[model samples]
Target: MTFPSPKAEAPAQRFQEATAAARTALEQLVAQANEAGWGTEEISVALLEAARFLNEANRKDPDPADDPAISDTPAKEQIGHGELYD
Candidate 1:
């Protein structure tokens, strides 16, 4: 089989890396919010939602040889979906 083009492969690799990074960032955001005593539950929920979205993206097209997976949802949605805050 012909090898996949690097142009197509690079983006996928980047996406996977980004998704992994986002997961870590979301966890930190929740922890920080809790420490600051500012809507800890709300922040935790939002971060959880973001993590889910990222996880889904990672699962959709998991090409380990390619780019990292990342969430495709809007930032606002990740921050506001299914939460007491909104």
Candidate 2:
């Protein structure tokens, strides 16, 4: 008798793939909704929630080809919050 070695089930991989697909769908939906002149607050909030969900699911940033929505702006910004209180 041979015991099966420990390994991830096929369903686990499928689930991860499904999660990634959902994230891609969401990103495209958000872009379309935004372009269609959907409410700013609604679109912004939805995108934020989607990002949180993907992060929780352990999804990495989409590939360049897959990420048409990638930001073009520089990452760093000088802090301009009011003068420090003495």
Clashes of each: 10, 0
Compose the digit string of candidate 1's lDDT tens values, residues 6-47.
333588886776666656766677677878886867887776
Candidates' TM-scores? 0.37, 0.37
Candidate closest to the true structure, highest lDDT: 1
Q: Where is model 1 poorest over a 10-residue stretch in terms of lDDT?
A: 1-10
- Model 1, global lDDT: 0.66
Quote model 2's TM-score: 0.37
Q: Model 2, 6-59: lDDT tens per residue?
A: 245698876776676667667777778989999767987987897798786565
TM-score of 1: 0.37
